[model samples]
Target chain A: MESFVDVFLFGKCYSVPDNLTIMGAMEYAGYQLVRGCGCRNGFCGACATIYRIRGDRELKVCLACQTKVENNMYVATLPFFPLIKEGFELEKVSPDVSVMMQLYPEIYACVGCNACTKSCTQGLNVMQYIAYAQRGDFAKCAEESFDCVMCGVCSSRTSGCRRSGTESSRICSPRSCRSPWRN
Target chain B: MYTGEILESMKKVEAARDANLALEPRRMTAEEKDALLSAYHPDYKESEFETLKIGVSRGDKVPHELAALLQGKPRIGAGDADLTKIDYDTDVLIIGGGGAGSSAAIEADNNGARCMIVTKLRIGDANTMMAEGGIQAADKPNDSPAVHYLDAFGGGHFAAKPELLYKLVNEAPDAIQWLNRLGVEFDKAPDGTMITTHGGGTSRKRMHAARDYTGAEIMRTLRDEVLNRGIPVIDYTAAVELILDENGRCAGAVLMNMETRELRVARAKTVILATGGAGRLHYQGFPTSNHYGATADGLILGYRAGAKLLYADTLQYHPTGAAYPDQIYGALVTEKVRSLGAKLVNAKGEVFMHPLETRDVSAASIIRECGDRGNGVKTPDGVGVWLDTPMIERIGGEGTILSRIPAMHRMFAKYGIDIRVEPILVYPTLHYQNGGLDITPDGMTAVENLYAAGEVVGGIHGRNRLMGNSLLDVIVFGRNAGRCASEKAKSVEPGALTLSHIDAFLKERGDAGIEGDTVSPKLLPVYTHGNPDVPKKPF
Candidate 1:
């Protein structure tokens, strides 16, 4: 009889048969997995994850796709973040910014086309920056949004506003002197 | 050499320089400074000084015969042959360090032959590393070598040589076992048996992979093994020509060190050319997954040495490469997605592929769809349809899919389209070549004492290749060539090769001069050849 292994993923634990790969284990646990583009060969550092055993005490950093599942092994997928500090400078480059926008536009999209600029409690250039960003001019957008106070008046009155009610309640009023753009 | 005309031309250049210097001290505004810089920049030509320099250079070196030669007139005695002496001696010399060469080196070492691998780049940088699918082998109980051979024959339209294909399929299992022993962590089933997956033009699940990075893993393992065996890998070394002995046998080869640009010679009992293929020649087919060094250098070398070159035109175009950001548009997307249940669909979400169609046919369908606009698909240049995204998501979740294929997800994400929610534009790119130096079943080329394997040799693939068979071919024929060459080398008499032949050859080819340019009229045809059908498109 083959030994079985238990692995946890997505807040759930499941038993995987012996000799099954981590990718196979993920499938057994009802998660679909695939190799990403760009040197899907571990060289690209994509698909990297955090893995640990529940009770046994060995810390190992391994590629999820490359590692085989062990009995009672616990694996967690970690978000990709480059280790080099200078690598963040890529954010300032236009091509890099454009690529990031293409990959995760949710982080950059501010679709509430601002009638909010007119209602700004601090009179910031919120509308202009949003317009620049919509046109894919991130530099211009960053420049224009340098002074937004994030008051709720724009959220309540703007027709394009689609943010959640909880988010609107946390908006910084002018009296607070704190910018909501800090995040 | 003492012509008055040369002296006058030199004087004219000196006068022009004087005039330019005399005008440099005038008070100039920013506009004037920009103009001056632009005019005198190193790239600037047609300036007075530049014109004079060109005139002087032309006047001093104008050969009347050269002008006629440039106008399609052949010069007499231009075919001067020079024999060069070989320097290094090895039992086996393997040209190209891709899958085939590395495998051959390992096998040769195992057979007790001193081997040296000469590659155009680092061993793993060839198109083999870009291969996304798995290596095909008859590993499952239901699968057999005969079935694998039949699939290959059918896929190539029976154009493949039956004998060579039989050897490939029969020997493939041992090759896979060798890879496993070398630490290639292939995808496994619950029983620990290697997981076999499907690919284009295959009836059975015969493909073994590590997710989509099958090639990279194989190359990495092979490279590690080659290094561990202490095989000398000469990277950045390109073989320029094969050196034939007095009896028309392949003695060795002349190589050009690409970095230092110096020439070196190797004399071996056997020569193996595993130099991969040529994909850059195609104009408008598909983006190439080939390395920059894959320029058919081995083919040219073999052809010049009188070895038969076959199937020079049958290039394989892989479907589904990214279409944006032109630098990487032609990179290969592993075909495992289809095996994992992803389907090819057009813009209207209709299944465009028969799911099991051959790769060539599938690529053609996608190209036609993009041309006709029948599907919402359009190649960036009306060349092919976009790969559907919803299908990928429907088969696998966005996060799950992204996690498995982080490279593809990140690439698409860079284009501002989440693959989970939006379709990705794709087109076929030149992925592989099915034809090259003609070789025997044992990987020996037509030239005596010469051998080849993997993508460098033709006939195994014929008109088309079966999915997963490429890696199999590399190991199977690679080992065969190595073992055969080692046996042959043991019996061959050691002969003397003098340096005089190489010196004469270099002189006839025009030695690299200190100041004078070395030009070759024979290179024009080779450099000008490219796929005429591909249209010029801006990145």
Candidate 2:
């Protein structure tokens, strides 16, 4: 017989197989998810989740597709992140901090709470990359934030900058817009 | 990440590295290659394939999983979708939002054609985003399109269609230039010369990349370009069935809103199916290195619309998929690792095969090593050989692995395995559908006005694809499909739209005595862990 563990999905308790991922456990509990599921692998970043252990106040973030179920785990899926990307022609723009400021505008609003860094599932130094964007060090920001999956966990935990800090790090990357400084 | 006995094998690999550096495995002769493939390749296992009972290629043999999908019933009845109530209409309708679809939309828009993209997931969520290897383009002075074509033809065992192969190799350099103009960051030297490397079966250094995130970077750039062009993209919507016109030319498709379970009709003068490969089908129950949306949707829809398939019996298994750690099983370990200098070693710390062999030969050799010789490392979940990754750092000095393949380093690092310091366990995983809907040089299917591109179309890579050609194939054929479809759309008028094809398909299946309880265009794979037998129904 397969051993089961009790997990609370949005505060409702269900017993699912201990070996299953949080995604599989949700399905085992009969929830046919439409939104909080994507590329069952770790690449897509569609299944960013927040959870806590029983009687533990330390919150953790992970991709639900990758995390295994734990006994008495409390899970919440963040399916949609409110991101309204400001459109700009990548060809005409340079990878400068001023361009990022013009597009996002809120990059200066970061209060250095470090919550964004703590919430990152990819383990990226979110605040450090944002600091790079602030100082016009786009190359450094690009290299540091190359692993960003755009999961929006950093924005979800922030109060001042919303998503601009993380978004600026991505915009600085040469992958999106070219840099005249680059040889 | 290895410990205990596996770590001991790692030590053996380390002890043999200096000697293995100079090792050169003998190349296989044509007769030897044929014998090895026939004996070990998954496609050569005759029992795994079955003849199709219905559709344009009725008697063709495809894998058993594919035969069922081809013979399966449509998701909806003919009466359920009203073609007259067109929800969205455009000059060109592009299905799928991967690299091909995005490229098609951009090209069509450039030709003054109004294009609307309908995709199952958010834009850029197709298999194109998962590709890690660089793209092939014979732009170097030492290389020419003729040489690239010859290499590809030989690698595919001379089964690739001549004209299609010619077009792919010829257009590749220009395709790379196009992506560069659109801001795709290819790895380049200080003087702006593209830094190129050799992929499997390549005679010259023609593979261009932006490190290991080559596809991700290209995809994001294309997605940005598509968005910036102000093209309308309908996300979370899939084309469940193709709508044929009264004249039997492909006209439009029935779109399913995956979230709302609502059906909508998209009528277009020309339709392009860029829906990608069938890796997510997990053919023969093999773990796949495909995106979740790669369930052979376009193949099923196109076949039902009377398009013939080419080389449907073949699939390409990427030889280096992560074999240990159940959570990350079957994830692709890019062939760039080998292109940079990593070698494949058996559990006994012996260099088994030349690392740069074509995908099929490499996969077969790995299987032969594991099965025939019992030279694979046994794991709790399965068996795999060592992809001696640390040799890359040793050959190129430290920090090379981090600079060149950071995505790979980070992927393993997440699981507590630092690939820069340790080797990874690997086995072949289903990676690409080498065969799909047959198309002309310009990507037009047998059904007039309908087009296919990317992995959804076949004959570009006959029975097996070399490492970097797939990325090139998408851009080359994608632009072809888009330009031709747009030009064709200008001269044509939208004919009567109907879903009578579904009725005809069902009738044909019934008449052929093909009985099965399956419905397809299987948009997603079911992962209800506790209830494996539950039917696949959208939430």
Candidate 3:
């Protein structure tokens, strides 16, 4: 009669058992892993978590090997962050929208703070793909920020998207796009 | 970074991709970059040519080589790893966690030793996180390190390995200032300098990139400075076999756990084998950008623990991958889009070869322009060429091909094709594995304290591999196999790891008679389910 679930992970509340998977509730809370785990399958975005549930003021984002562990969740993962890297010279920029408005001038400090599309747990629309990459419509900002698993949790609850999940890999340039055998 | 004295002090400098003499729409002549450096040389298929010309691809290993042809499989057997219950005991175990086992567990925990890093997956998933363009370093200002060591052992045909190509051309600009003191934001130049470009066989513009995910920003900044210097990793796990000690050295590794198919024994007095290479043994059928734990499992557990695997059948394909959508098929498209000028064309758009030549002559000019000068472009899994990529956003502007090939503008905008406005299709996949585990530029191998780094060590890029010389042979041999295996793990003394060297390497592959079926090329047969083509779903 399996059913348990407390969670609160890196903050200790454990319990686990039911519906597991926050990498099986952090190895059922003993946390043997030396670093945040990876490729637990949902395809190498290397985990990417960020949660909060206790009463849900809403701050989620998925992939701790594909979601699950919930009741009062709280989680935290991110794998690797502190992103914002600029490094210029695409021939002095010009693909429109002032090239992400002069290398992330915080994309015009958008105040429409939908707190990064209400903390996108893959519902995307992270402020409509930063307003479709500020209207240059980079092919619908590469088709609605292509399932953004940047996991900087909508650039840490964006107020204007400075870290935009580590500068959305500098206006996103996708990879591991699938195929080459692997169902 | 171009040299020949900076391409004779420049002239038509339209810039941003420099090893000078601008690419196509014509300008090359340094004797046409010395006649596109003698292009073309990929001949196999005589039933993969006597298993790659007399085994281990012509370096000759014979006796059940290619990692002792995967010794007696069915694991956890012989004493199901109780070896006095080691469950990990370290001084330096480190085995393949990409970007040379996370820079040899941060240079063996900064040389005081105690390192760990185990990995098969997670820990910046390997293929050095799909190394997108940039990581060759002669460190600009008319570059040196002897012209990046005469353009890396004169682009491989020189059959490299001279002191591991003089310690990867004298420690690649101090491993690019130690990956810019471990932050890896690379590109630089609004008066800050650094930015050097140009790839394939090169003579200068010493690569150095970060813009296009340069190996996912140096394998996520060396897996985040080896997990912020706490350095302990075991990760999903994999080591399969390698225990050695009774004087053959290597002492640790048996590990396993690829998701609880449990098994253990990690004793280490310094092992290292940085696992990489075997391009998932897809070998000559192609399609592979590697990284689903590029299964060689440390080259057949470091050749059943005798180690010395040079040129294990030359591989390196990457002359631009992505054979077409299906998720993003075979990945990679970053030789910084032909050193930033883009132009490989074919399907009648013309322009054959000389797209900066040199990845086995631009992958043997797209396998001789799609076999026998027919001029490629057939594609339903073969024959192609046409990288033009909207002429680097019409000559570097309009977000210059999404800011200098932003991971090929997010892998051709995941099939919707916006590689900064069209033109993508490519070929040559398989990318890097030039052959492995045969170290010694102080990265050991040949047994003793094991050691190996990056593409799982081999004759440092010899049967072709120049495009940014494998992220500068993974941080100058992962800081010389972590400071020479932490000064040989301080004169090692911790012994005891035996299965009598896997029963004398299975009685020396059963007295050199050699047979098959011990598997562990990670137990063969894995088309995995992206299986034999089905993908089409761009979402």
Candidate 4:
């Protein structure tokens, strides 16, 4: 016997089978996704999503393909957010804070707010890494944020989140930096 | 949680860890590997494949599922599309936006060609991003391109085309250096020396990585370079069919908007098909470690465009996919684990075959243990052997697994399985498509003005690919295809565009009485729960 749960996807309610991931339940309810889905594993951050439980006031961000459904869960896929992206030639750029600032000056605008840190789906110390970037300790910043999937949840939460990622990427010398997209 | 008996077996594995650490199994010779592959490898099983009835590959044996798609009808007819309306015009049109496509676009743009990238998903959303092991490059003082060529040549069983193999090996070091110059942050030692490690079938430790996220690092770097160069990338748009000129030269492709179902026309002087592989087909009913878009889109598209495929019958099954804890089944457990000193142990908690053999040999050994010997640990979903991951920490010391393979550790941790303290069950999962469109050393396919790179181009790896070479293959051949295609684009002009090749392909299938409900270039695989029509395990 199969149990069912009510999931509100983009404000439309559907009774989906229990034990299905949010992505799976959407498909089970017959939504052929054209967007907000990538690797179908957790690697690609295409399926970044925000949801809330029936009684909880707090919103949670997660990879929809990896998170299981809860009864009365409210789900909405995160759309693409247009952010400031600068372009530069890698051969000419130096691994210094000055180059990072020249490309993205917005890193100085970080207010030390923990909003980006709390909003990270990958549980990275987003604010701390950003501070490291601000202090020109980019090697430390690169190590702390190596596992970031660049889901942009952090950027959605704060003003300085976008450039912080690109800052760490700029400082990714022969050090251990694995930015999902340094751009 | 593991079953009680499985837990009991794990205890045995833990107890025997010290012995397993010192265990040294003899490596198989070429002839021995050949005998083992013939007797155990799934590719050698004749009943699993059938001869094609239509198209250029007619009478050639291939998997039945693929044969159906190969014989599938064209999505658009010759007269259906408006060839007069070209939305995007470029000198080089690169299909797919994975590593290969990105590499192709970068080099094409570098060669002074107006290039555009079109992908089914986001630019960096690809198997390349999901590749967890490392990239191969022979740059160490002791390792030369000659040695690298011999290692790769012998690894592929000497069946690899010498020209393509030579190009791949010779240019690998340069490719690595290019990526480094492009801001790809490779792992380095304390003295600023690049760190290299061993991969399966490698004589020297030439594998360079950005920790466990080698592919992600490389992919993100290339994608950033593409964006930095202002290369036009059409996201969420897939190339449904390749368009050819009236003179039978490759012109461009018909692009489909995955969301709006709108058709877009792209006209170009040359087309580079880097559309990647077919693991999403779930060949042999096995779970795959591919991205959602790895549905063999390039194979069918190239086939319809009058290109010849090589070794379509062969596929690479990665030996260490997670097989237990049903939720994460079929996810990749990278070969880096084996390279890091993990051992494959059977039900009796004993070390099995040498874990560092080629993927095919390693997968066959696992299958033999699970099926023929009945030594696999059984659960409701399937059977799998244990890969002693804790041995990595035992060998490399504490914090090794966490730092070296963070993504892997996080994946298991999500399922409440701490791999640092225990072993994980593994089974062979469909990993790579070893063969595709046959190409020259420079990535020119059978069709003029059509080039291929990455997994779509076959014959570079012969029947099997070694670890790290795939990442190298994308950059090496992708740059070659891009640079050569752009140079060729300078002199040639596209004639009147038409879908006559697809029309001819469909007509051939119709004449052969080969009918299918499916369409070519299957953009996305259908995934639904509890489809009794599809077998659970074909093997």
Model 1 Cα lDDT, one tens digit per residue, B1-539: 11243234323333343232223222334354345334422112222111101211122221221211111111112122233544677999999888888888988998999999997556666667666678999878999999898889977868888889889999888888888766666767657788787787788889888656677667766765676567899876767667766666787777766556567778888888887766644323344666545656665566545566555445577766656433245666667655655555555444555544666665655665555455533333343344544455555555646534544554455435566655455677777777777787767777788888878788887777777888888888888888888888888754544223333433533432212332212111121112233332210
TM-score, every prediction: 0.59, 0.94, 0.33, 0.94
lDDT of each: 0.57, 0.85, 0.64, 0.84
How close to the true structure is residue B462 of candidate 1, measured as C-alpha lDDT? 79
Give lDDT tens digits, candidate 4, residues A5-108. 99999989988778678988877776666688888777777887889998897778888877889998999888575445666665566667776566555656
What DockQ values do the models have?
A: 0.02, 0.44, 0.03, 0.38
Residue-level lDDT of model 2, residues A98-118, one tens digit each, is 875676555566667676777
| True-structure lDDT of candidate 1 | 0.57
Ranking by TM-score: 2, 4, 1, 3
Q: In angstroms, what RMSD does candidate 1 have relative to the true structure?
A: 26.3
lDDT of 3 by residue, B430-455 (tens): 77777677777788877888888888
Best by lDDT: 2
Per-candidate iRMSD: 20.9, 2.8, 16.3, 4.9
lDDT of 1 by residue, A26-94 (tens): 655544222211122223223445556777664334444335677667776542332111111121334
Per-residue accuracy of model 4 over B75-139 as CA lDDT, tens digit each: 88877779999999999999999999999999999899999999988898889988989989889
Q: What local lDDT does model 4 show for residue B59?
A: 77
